[model samples]
Target: MTCLFRRIRFVLPTCLAGVLLAGCAPNPEIATVTVPRAAQHVSPAARALLPDPNPPYTPASYQSRSLAAYYGHMQDKLLASGKLRQDTGQGVAITADQLTKDFIDIAMKDEYMRGGSGTMHRSMDSVLRRWEKPIRVFTVFGATVPPTERERANALVASYVNRLARVTGHDIQMTTRENANYYVMFMGEDDRMPFGETLKAAIPEIDPATMNVFKHTPRNQLCVALTFREQNGSPVMGKALAMIRSEHPQILRLSCLHEEMAQALGLPNDSPTARPSIFNDDEEFALLTTHDELLLRILYDRRLKPGMTQEQALPIVRQIAGELVGR
Candidate 1:
């Protein structure tokens, strides 16, 4: 099969969706990014503890129509999981040797489609025509963490931010640093497994020290928020609370602290892949933060409270800024 209908122009930012559609609008238009420090191959005592993947929010772009019926109900659950073979050839053509192997595996049995990425790499590439499908991604982090390594880096940043914000509804920035010590090489083919059997086959009802692989990062005092659509307030939480009131003014604000961040991330915040639920559906509206302040902002679309007017919020502010620092 062969297809190419390139027409994507996402824009969102009308005073951060009027402060999440109802926080009483106003306050947004900040957005910044710069997390770079943590190379030298870690281990100087875990590079003195790591965390800081650029911060200063403004990263939102979720598609709709109920996400095209949730990507055709996840491609009819990977073609009815009969594990491929329903004439795998045509049905979505793509000659040129499958776009130079730029992906082609439509689920069949989902092994993250041979390599990594998910949604079986966009349902084997045929570029998801009409029947609906389009997935985007953005994952970020950083931490050296404190409070005596706060229960294994906040239970590995709350089960890796509830398993990548349930597959990427975007928004979950955490930072904290001094020296550094990062390394999350989860390649593929079970990528050499054993991070306690990959968080117990993706958080099987937690408990294992709340699925701990020797703790990572997590404490508190960090800030940033977003992930609400049709809510009437949220240009990524008015650009992460207007950059935590101008450059992290000792950030501190918590609402759904999920049982005190799962008891300071000792783990088990109802695991089953942790929280968020395998991504998309606008990733169940993302936006989360913590790990000792300064970074992970993200905003735009004027309507910013305290009397709005940043040129009415520069045309849906969004200009890339993902920096989980190092590997």
Candidate 2:
């Protein structure tokens, strides 16, 4: 009976191993083209990106403090150049699908010092692709500010940084391009990779010598626009929403959520504070939008588009330009 029991135990162990091996075979091939990440999912352009995963699970925030440090270094460069003038805000529209797990891995390994941990907001392994629309912010300086008043100029620069932080809920350090004077700060939504990465790749090489076109456009072209006064309530957002719906019906709404300046602008990559801000403890803002803002230049085309002649176009262009000048 002891001999029989030993034989049965050995056979049972061998059978279990065989069963496990049989279950390890590769899955059958399915013909499918890998999805390509196109534009910011938070924009109307978002629909052009890819679909969200079913039974959706919130991804861990992959905000990188290390990258924000690089932003600080870049801001120092712009500030020292004496080119940056007024405090400015800018945002990039990036397709999260463009970000690959491999790219995140490589960046963290090389550029950033994050180890193989969830702390950096990267996925553990390959999975279905998703989309995000993160907005980056920075300060812009005025060209006529005169280079001689360095002290006042720096103070102005700091104020601009504060205003930008207040507007987008990002506490970003400003940076400048090689030839420019102002530092371009960047901030994006939580764990949204391509959005932040896209701006980081662009600002360092921006030619301040060329022109400040961003000065003439909306703060974040990536997001639908909403104008708020110093003391207005969410009802103001309702007006913007009505405009979006009446003027542009085809666009899809992403996040009209208002984010708090005090909370969102503090520490870098703080996921808890990065969510949409509410007036009286709501989950999101009363703000509204359509996905097609990138192509939805309703205001631009209707009021700002230049005509065939330069003279014909200057009025509209200048009017919009003046608004951006913060007058």
Candidate 3:
């Protein structure tokens, strides 16, 4: 299975695209009321450079609220990026069984979250948390990228944010302001390695040394994008970093944008078995799929909480997955 990172971009239905990107906050229209229809499933593009599990997961060192605030931020985001496809399909017909099967396979098993640098084995407790209360918004910017690349990056990211909001019914939004907690940026070749310093400067919680390893390690094997975070003990992801190789072909660039952006939302691991998904190493689909969207919906559902074990979450996941079908 040579995952092909095809060149593709699917245009959203005129009405839906307008509604999702319709207006700004407060009396929110797109994220609050709009629900895009689920289209049929289609097979698509290939691979991404997923983050290897390094340093492993360790319980946070004890710190008082004042000190923790001074020393740390949000919880860790699983780093996952992807290969892309020929086009963004309308969507797939994801039935209840398909939904549960894919969700369980992705959510319950350790194998699904495999990384390259080291093996990451975890208990079920980590699968649970999400942005239950906090704001979910992102702003796109440039690194060494020129105006044209920045513009293209912003547009591609905006499309996925709309798709993510509609599919999951979460309050995810895209903005041009400085308040965005999640930041997606395009990095030109010259700005690549040093971009980690830029991230550390903006959000001091990020370890600059780790960013160095991340940027350099992936370049050796192309098609890798990165999504890191500044998170505390809770499952809620506060700040995230998405970096795309600015010089990639439009298709691969678009592909990296889709995977890294989606992964930052909580589905951070890549499973080889995740068919028809960008979250898999197989690179079966370059663009995000209906199955992946349902996973997003399940993750943000009010019934589920952050930091739940597989033992605690399976039943609730099934319940939510049941209602999501044919909706």
Candidate 4:
């Protein structure tokens, strides 16, 4: 059965090995696009809540540099061990039956549940959720992040969002923060404290527990996404917020972008059995996989509506999976 609640998904720093190493080079295509500066789009209301656009780069900047180095080292180790596969096409062959099961596990489950007092507890249960309205993604960056980095992030997100739209057949596009229903913020170490106010300004009804997690997310928790339903007992997602640690180096940051943004769309749970997919916690795939594209297609398929119980959705999911896999 489906349970209605806000869903928060976290991507852990799991390791695996594979070929097809993802190069750290920035995309030349995205670089050509003239990205609007993030500071220019910040609303007057949100401006006061956010960190300064040009704060003195000092202690926090130092910490962020250190973090970048550490994560860079970690990425090197992961690459050496053959983890973080960017070649999505070269993974284990997935069958129709396996795809169906994976869809149910990833799409119809809640990764974190909220207690009566508004604290989050790790729990698992059925919950069918997806966006009914068009998705407009807006990104914001912390003061410490440089202009070049911001441009790279903007281009990456824009390109990825378009790819997602094409995969899901959903109306997803990047917009200004003022007009976006989905907010993606890249915050550095110094921006942690002020991030709460920024979130409050953006979503006044945000849960304190969720804010706490964003403010003090553990280093191991690479990135997070929180999706809110229209109302209690409702399955339609109305808003979403994703916080990515700006300290992450390029590949890890892109990995976070792929997983967290996709999770925010609806697939909020990870399955160890999900092969060659970013939805799995194994970190085998650094980017969205061919398997994952099919999953998104199934999620937005017209036959399976939001709030559907597992029993109500599984038959349709299986059929869709078979059709997608040509079974």
**Predicted candidate 4, C-alpha RMSD:** 9.6
Model 4: ten consecutive residues of lowest lDDT: 28-37
For residues 1-327, could you state the per-residue lDDT of candidate 1 as single tens digits? 222111111112121110111222222121111111111222344422322232223222232233324334433433343211222122233222222121111101111121222122211211110001111122222221123323443454456555433433333334333221111211111111223343222212223432331222111112222111211331111111001111111111111222122111111111112122111111121223221100111111111221222232222111211211111
Collision count for each candidate, in order? 50, 27, 28, 4
What Cα-based lDDT does every candidate model obtain? 0.21, 0.22, 0.47, 0.69
* lDDT for position 6 in model 3: 24
Give a tens-digit lDDT track for model 2, residues 205-275: 22221112122212112212211111111110100100111011111111111211111211001121211
Which 10-residue window of candidate 3 scores lowest in summed lDDT? 27-36
After superposing candidate 1 on the true structure, give the runs of residues whose Cα lies further than 4 Å from its correct spot: 1-32, 35-38, 43-156, 160-162, 165-327
Ranking by lDDT: 4, 3, 2, 1
The best candidate by lDDT is 4
Two-way lDDT contest, 3 vs 4, winner: 4
Please provide TM-scores, in order, for all candidate models, with all chains considered together. Answer: 0.18, 0.18, 0.64, 0.81
